[model samples]
Target: MGDPGGTDYAVSAEFYDLLQAEPDRRRAERWFAGAAGRARHGIVDFGAGTGIVTRVLLESSGVPVHAVEPAPAMRTVLMSRAAAFGADRRARLTVHPGRAEDAGLEAVADLAVAANVVGCVEPAARRALWRAAARALVPGGVLLFDPPPVGLPDGIEALEGLGPVRMGADSYLADVTRVPDRGVLRMVFDYRVERAGLAVRGAREEFPVWPAEPAVLVAEAAQAGLELVAAPHPDLLAARRPHG
Candidate 1:
């Protein structure tokens, strides 16, 4: 939840399920379903915004889940949904309030999944986030996430500057701040968006953010001591921590 509206989560959260489309959702669903088969103890949803994926993990595995979100607004939604899953019982879900960089998940879970999170910080912050995720895992645990592919067309970056991207009555656009480094570009895109059919418009800004290339993500995970289990793609990426 770490400030999806104001953060990288953005209007993507508002129309998240919609824009994610069925195929993409199924892909992620399948990925977690597979992960559930491998994870024996517990799982941590790194960004856990709204708990969409968190619920998926719980339903798929019924293992312990820690839904960590930094954004109060998103966390509220997550807690509400957690109740639906009987998460209030100590046996099920645990909610943690913090950003990925400081989530302190180490030895707390058998696996950690970042989903679409982790790409919303500066390069240093992004690396730190990955390190934190790796630390949160037990040996042989996994970290899974898919950030937007790097090398965005120059036009896309240009379009980003032309106010917010308007779809229906909502605007998914925000001002961007970028710091370029070799192949990596650290950036933050703040979005003020409204739901397509809903009457309420929620506004917020995301900061301390950025995106990275798929290869860079893998290397960073490796640097964090996670073996690349799935390389980032338009589809998915999965990585594992080897058991000693």
Candidate 2:
């Protein structure tokens, strides 16, 4: 989770949900809910990110949920959402402040997830997460994650139009450019907001991500003592720890 705005998700935190509403659900959210519905024990959501998936997990799964998020801005939003939940759901949720690798969960979860978060850090950090999840999971538990759908292009590629999401008179727009630099993928998010045809605010948010291709991802998981399970989608991954 490399920082650009003095914090990991400082700039994008406000507009994240609005801009990512549909695409985020389409990516893996539906499946995430289904998995939670089928879960028996507990769940660990690494990089819980504004409690989007955390909300789903809390609703579908009767088990306790540990939501881990590192960014203060993102966590603030996450806490807001979790606090608004009814007593039952709120009681089952515990929000933690840390990265996935630093979450000292010891064999307490039936499932562990790193939703759309694996590429946020470098290879070593990703491996640390895998190992941490392996340690936190029950012997037969599974670890799941959504990897980046697209990587940085050979040099630089830009997409000028993403959306102009309208929430009343305010219009939010997002554009992105991908740059391959120094063995990492840098995604620059250009965000703008308009109030009744007047530009109000804008931000250029940069995120450095690891381009973990499928083969390399699998290898890394195996090295952390987890074996690849049948993935729900070709773009997603699930790895299971050995039954001891």
Candidate 3:
């Protein structure tokens, strides 16, 4: 959601889901299932883009969920999805119109999850984002997320690739380029959408991501009162607030 001077989600939002592979959804579902077991009251989906993870948490846990998203276009889609839910699910869902770094949320949730979002946060704002998550949780509450891989793949110089995907009548092509340097990956996502054999939409979103070492994140989180905990999944990192 936090575009940060990059192309907005006006066009990209339409093809966002297409970018998510089955494995990505399954990973999120598994993480949510584990976190939901420990949650007592509510949960927060920090960057609830299009409510993908938010919907999973709502249906899986049937608990109150705060979906914090920033981009207007993406939020529009999320709100629409939330509106279509049954009364029971709707009653348990809240969509916040802000980024994770400063969502101004008041509810102290039992669990907080940020999926594929930490890497997109600006370096200077990462601490604030983590601290905000720490402050939003009740004592002993957990935060689960998967940051980008710590380093570039072996022998991969400035990763770049393009792929084509289709959703119903729309066809889309996504071009991804990443240049890793100084612990940061400067990534760009360029998309082109076509309908009826004609290119109709396009978007280019660019941002810098800091892939902090696991140990570094643990230390930083400790400063914010969150103790790093061993995660069940190898790709995920979990932290917990100290119990009173």
Candidate 4:
């Protein structure tokens, strides 16, 4: 499950505010607060787009924050937002220009988080990213993140079926529906579209979208030498690098 539909931060960065406003922000904050508590030092928001969660951790939780954003445009927005939150002060913040896998954090951070950014890569790449984050942490440091879901909107499949849409291809239409369970919400992605080359050509397929399922993701982390400490919700899970 590489970044299907091409998850471009430069493009998505513009609509990031809308994306965060959904239940996503609330979900992330809960896990981050818990994960940071395990850290003796401070926390780093890996792939911290626009610094939304970063600001929340700084303003609400009063945690020292460091943000990593690879997209230049997103980093720009994040820095501006951090400054507004008064996160530039030593007591509150630091902003870095990097990605989850390549951030040159000076020391092993207390926590590293990647909220809603794991879906940007294919599964193999995502595994590599997890390993990278694990390498940046201290023995007891934590890593938290959420992958999209196996169930996306049906419309998205319809749209993707139109053809394997190129990275910079024109945006297509998609509608998402929520299937509620006792605890978590499963999103069924529905897409509608016609083929690109042959205007008359069209089709649809349902991809079992398991964005970032806790079982699979946690297992991957464990394989990378992380220990699953807590997973408050399926959509939100936390693992800590094992201590000696």
Candidate 5:
């Protein structure tokens, strides 16, 4: 979103859904379901990577969904999926090929979701995200997203065995690790696909993420007329745009 182009997810986009575990989707869906229940107007989805959450929002929520995605590769799949949905549902999903921070929406949605996306940029870009969300949301509109880690940890995360998934005699696997570099954390995603137990394709994608804590987000959002709200879970954070 704030990173401008989703270049970071370029190569990994192909294996994204294949690598994502069902539990991960369930966790986000719980939040989505709650938002769907609360959102009376519509939902503005930022960083709609490959329509992972977009489909869920459409299926669970009848509200109109405005999805903003910048990466061509990722948007291709996102729109492709939206195309397959029934005409009624398809009509409700609008895909914007640009940065969420530049979506130019003004108080049109009741809920905004930027799931698993903020960690892709530094604090300045993240600030743009907060400001954009604040502008796009109606008063009391809630923005749901994952909070960035305060600092880098000392291990690798395979995203809960996010791979080794078999596909037509091929297997794909991935792991995520953080590295501190130049005062920012580098989120590294390593992926590999194997056929006949031999490596067929592999890629390593790196993104510079802010190491700022949750307080930074609260403070940053506040500067944009948003206040932190008690989220249903600690892993996620909710910030509401204030009226006037």
Candidate 6:
């Protein structure tokens, strides 16, 4: 099943970096550093939106990185950011215009990562994604990713929100809605940009996420020929392809 919301990132791309700036940076640093310590060369980043994680991996290691992303707007931004890198760094990066399932990458990576992308894929496509990740890795290579929290929190309704965060002349509010039957979380962000003391511009975008259970993910990985391993961090899962 495809994403029903379509390319909402085309609209939210303007604020994507700003909204996720610090947290994504820190996450990229921590995750890529760990991956780099183990993998000797070649890293593949699936769903490499805006190249945030790609940049971190490039800087953390001298290994070649294949950044795979499907969204046109996100890929444009990622390519633009990668162009800013030095010749040596830029030469080490290759942008793949496809999703994990059709990335057409060689099975040579020592490490593969999906970061927060797993939740974005529909449940039916998740098994294929795991298989593709397995195909992209060398024997004994590692795959690391973060899955969404299992089930709903107690006492929370379908929708939940907090106060808006203001940055400069712009302010934004975030709301998340749980669709239990579909196993998806729909996140909406409303933004208002002020101009000449007037709130002249506004945008509302929705991003739907499908979170999988840990047990289910482990089973999927096993079907993809990956063995679930203990992750160094609690927030991420590590799976390794069998050496034999």
The estimated TM-scores of all candidates read 0.69, 0.90, 0.84, 0.64, 0.91, 0.86
Q: Count the backbone clashes (under 3 Å) in each candidate.
A: 14, 0, 0, 22, 0, 0
| Residue 68 of model 6, lDDT score | 83
Q: Over the full model, what C-alpha lDDT does candidate 5 score relative to the true structure?
A: 0.79
Clashing pairs in 5: none
For candidate 1, give the lDDT of residue 160: 34
Q: What lDDT would candidate 4 get against the real structure?
A: 0.58
Task: Summing lDDT over every window of 10 consecutive residues in candidate 2, give the lowest-scoring window.
Answer: 1-10
Candidate 3 structure, TM-score to reference: 0.84
Please write out the lDDT profile of model 5 over residues 1-244, one tens digit for every residue. Answer: 3234355467777877777736546866887777766678889888887787887788778889988888887788777778888899988888888787777888889899887778776567788888989988999899988877778656544344456799898999977776777667776778998999999988887777777777788889999889999876667889998776
Error of 4 at 153 (Å): 6.7
Task: Output the lDDT of residue 64, model 3.
Answer: 83
lDDT of 1 by residue, 1-244 (tens): 3532225444445544333334444665766767765678888887787777877777777578887787766677677767787634436788888776566666877777777666555567677766777777888777777665475334324223324445766655445545454545545444445466443444443334355577888798789877887543436677787788
- Sort by lDDT, top down from the best: 2, 5, 6, 3, 1, 4
What is the lDDT, from 0 to 100, of the residue 143 in candidate 5?
91
TM-score, candidate 4, is 0.64
Across 149-196, the per-residue lDDT of candidate 2 in tens digits comes to: 445577888866667998888999988998899878888999999998
TM-score of 2: 0.90
lDDT of 6 by residue, 1-244 (tens): 1121124377767767766756787987876676765667689888888888888888888788988888888888888889898899999899887667777776769898887777777776677778888898999888888875666444324454433557766565444454444455665666556545567677777766776678989998899899999776778888898898
Report the candidate with higher lDDT, 3 versus 5: 5
Of candidate 6, the 10-residue stretch with the lowest lDDT total is: 1-10
lDDT of 4 by residue, 1-244 (tens): 1121233344444444543443445765666665555556777777676777776566444456777666676777777765565424446687766555665664457677777656555577577667776787777787776655654343312122112233243333334445444333443444433345433322232222335565777788788877877665567567788888
lDDT of each: 0.64, 0.79, 0.74, 0.58, 0.79, 0.74
Pairs with backbone N, CA or C atoms under 3 Å apart (clashes), candidate 2: none
- In model 6, where do residues sit more than 4 Å from their true spots? 1-8, 153-182, 196-198
